[model samples]
Target: MQRLSENPNTLLALYRISQAASSANTPRDAYIVIIEELQRLYDPHAAAICLINPNTSLLEIDYALGYPPNLPELAIHPGKGISGRAAFNGEPILCNDVETDPRYVKLIEGVRSKIAAPMIAGGQIIGALNVDRDHVDGFTEDDLDNLVHIANEASRVLQSVWRKRQLVMQSSQLNALIEVGQSIVSKFEIQSLWQTVTEAAHQLTGAGLCTLQLYESKEKKVSLQTVFPENLEFLDMVGDIAVTESLAGSAIRTKRQVEFSNITTPDYRDLHDVPHDSEVTSCLSTPMIYEGKVIGIINVFTRERHRFANSERRLLQAFASLAAVAAQNAELYSRVFNSEERLRKSERLTTLGLLSAEIAHEIRNPLTVIKLLFSSLDLQYPESDPRNKDKQVIREKIDHLEEIVSKVLSFGKAPEGIFTHWDIDDLIADTCLLVRHKMGQLKIDLRHHASSRKARVNGNKGQLQQVLLNLIINATDAMPKGGILTITTKVEQIERRSVVALYIEDTGSGIPENLVARIFDSFLTGKAEGTGLGLSIVKRILRSHHGDISVTDTSEHGTTMRIELPFVR
Candidate 1:
């Protein structure tokens, strides 16, 4: 190193570079100043400043002078060329004969000599300061020594800017984390919760897109839930990924965060087969965990191979934590609402049972008296007379009334029917026997079909029978002119659970559209003669037994009702 008194020009050059470094906004800008001074001092054919990328552990060209237009922005790894060797070895290299030197990789034509020195910071090489000449023996030992000292000064400036940037970024991260915390506590809907997380990540990192994926824990699969700026063309290619083979899955398995600077060329050998669109260049996936369990993953995507900063990682991790809690709370709220709905249905069943018993008792006494009087007068008329036929008709109507009264009496019984594992096919067969005769009277054809397999459901037999009976009665009423009535039973999967489905289809004029919605409401009737309590009571019974009924199909041609009961595995 030359003293300021011995070399006035060197002092002036140092002052200019130092002043520029102090005022520049970034390391790149400072490098521009430093390289300019080096060019004037050594009079080389080219000068370039390269910085080490911590993510890739390679030297990245930050700024260059006199380089050819065709030169790509190639990463310089350890021992690849002169610059790479200097940066990797943490030393200075001065080659007066470029063609003879093995470390020299040809760049500009006619360049015969070059000198490179490592930029060191915190006892490690961070980059290389490289200069090339067009003629042999163009540089001296003094020039190499001079560049090394200047490179050290440049490294100090880079370290300062890096530290300052980190401080600002960390501060921003803290604020973003606080916002995420607020959203977690307040939001409950699944869509809204994921939207908040993506929006927060986009804003925090200034990334163009952020994706949220949901994990189906039972199925052990992950699927893309939502993407920010929903207009990407790659949406069609997004598909479910198995937990064992995904970058997000690794994070979930380890319960940590994973990042990829270049997903097109992932570092992990296992990810070589992972198919991602070319538009996504860099990505980071963090597991959304709650209570030490992985819930899902929040992914941040960029269109370029960006070295994700520490602040970005921290912010995303914070988001994952908050998002996981929000998801958990939303699911818990859903389960709670479902439970409350069941409780309300149970309460409604109890009230209806009490009311039905009161009405049945009042109607039974008068019906009994009429039956006794009719029996006394039955032998008075001649067997061939029309009066005798009319008397028989009245007696037959009395018995139907008695049956209706008996059904009402049964309504007062427990809603949770005998809890037993019974074959649903057998139950349907027994109930069809009661309605088969009535269906024949109306000339309505009946068809029954069953699956080859048997599925048993646990429920009260009487309550389930009553439910089937009510639906059959409605089917007969719908087709007074005689249409086909079909009942089909099968075992299927619902929400990943085994279930038994009983389908009742009637080829009668479909229910009026206006009345279909309210058909299960108490006292809402389509017929002019009777109170509409049959279907309402059926709904209550099915619900009490942990089964449900829905109108699966309906039109002018017919109506189909489907009742599903959970089956034991």
Candidate 2:
């Protein structure tokens, strides 16, 4: 230390080296100056600075001065060369004889001496700065002291630059996270949001591939939600990495980020059956947590083994948080949309009910007066008189009008039925009785068949009656030209459970092919004066009973509607 301050020329050089080190924005720049100062002060023929490459676990010459252009860049393991020894021991070494010193590994063959000092900061030897001289006994103890001082200054500068770089990188990553967060929030559609998230993750990590795996907690399995490149062959390779088998799976199970630097190693390689062409050397997988449980994983893949810096991990974690929020929001939005649609349908049904009640009310009073007049005229005449035949014709016409009016009144009236252990066969009979008048008017032959097994289903006596009645009425309407109307009841077994089926078939003009799909939709009518609610109301009643009504067959010949109900235990 005293020799370093004794020489005026060496002192000035030390001062200049300190100034250059202080002004350097990075450790590499400061290291270059320190090596140059060592050459100027000691007159070395060759100088080089080697630093550790953490990824490969090898020392590499990051910056070198005064070495031949054709000379291979220095690369050595820890504790391998004279410089590696200084780096390994964290001390300064001045070897006076190149051939005699065990620490020296000759790079340029000649009789020479060498001085090497560790570039250490925070108690870790990052690498070493070394200078070589062609003359023997060229470097002195004083020169070693000055070189150590300059190496210390260089180490300090490098540490500062490294810290500054970390802060800058962190700032950039944070800005990217903010941008991704904003993008996810702005996208309301789930598919669009997923696309944005995948794209953002790829951009942030500079990864060759990005994938999101969505887990169905109830199913205890995950599915690939989205994969970038759409056709990337690595999907099968990386996608096969199970949540129970690989590092990604471990992260998902732990609800944290799992990083693998050396994917080619036996430990990690054994976990997945990756293909050679996948070339996935490094991986960072973060869990997507929602409601305090890991719901999925977001994985990023790089082409080369990477020591995922802390900043990169943090940025990815932030992005994962945003993805979770977006997923939850998208699910909620879908639910809200579905609820709103149900409310609208309910409102429309209520409006239709009210309008039907009003129309029935207006038509009932006038029809009652006509029925009273017809009855009086029939009483004033005798059945055997010559004029009775003409009077009978008038009476029959009045009765038909009354029957039509009664049907309209029944449609508007609230259902009423005495619940009983009634056979579905009997119910079909009652429904046929109601529609028998219309069937006669249309000249349609109505055939009814019942299951010999006596199948019974639990339901509202009156509502079920109404359902059958509406279906029969619609069936008759379909056959305006008087085709056969077939009503059949049978017991069926579905999924190893017994069910009762009621089928109604008509031979009238079948529903148009285009309108057939929506025939059961409310307010969808094919007739000029049809209310269009018959099939819709039938469907509603069947659904309320935990049953289903559907069109089983339709063609130009006819349409067949079937209703299925769970068998009563």
lDDT measured at residue 109 in model 2 versus the true structure, 0 to 100:
58
Assess the local accuracy of residue 242 in candidate 2 as a C-alpha lDDT between 0 and 100. 47
Question: Best TM-score goes to which candidate?
Answer: 2
* Superposition error at 512 for model 2 (Å): 44
Worst 10 residues of 2 by lDDT: 269-278
Candidate 1 minimal-lDDT segment of 10 residues: 266-275
lDDT at position 536, candidate 1: 77
Stretches > 4 Å off in candidate 2: 7-22, 26-28, 68-73, 108-111, 229-242, 245-247, 266-276, 379-569
**Which pairs clash in the backbone of model 2?**
479-508
TM-score list, all predictions: 0.56, 0.64
Candidate with best lDDT? 1
Model 2: lDDT equals: 0.75
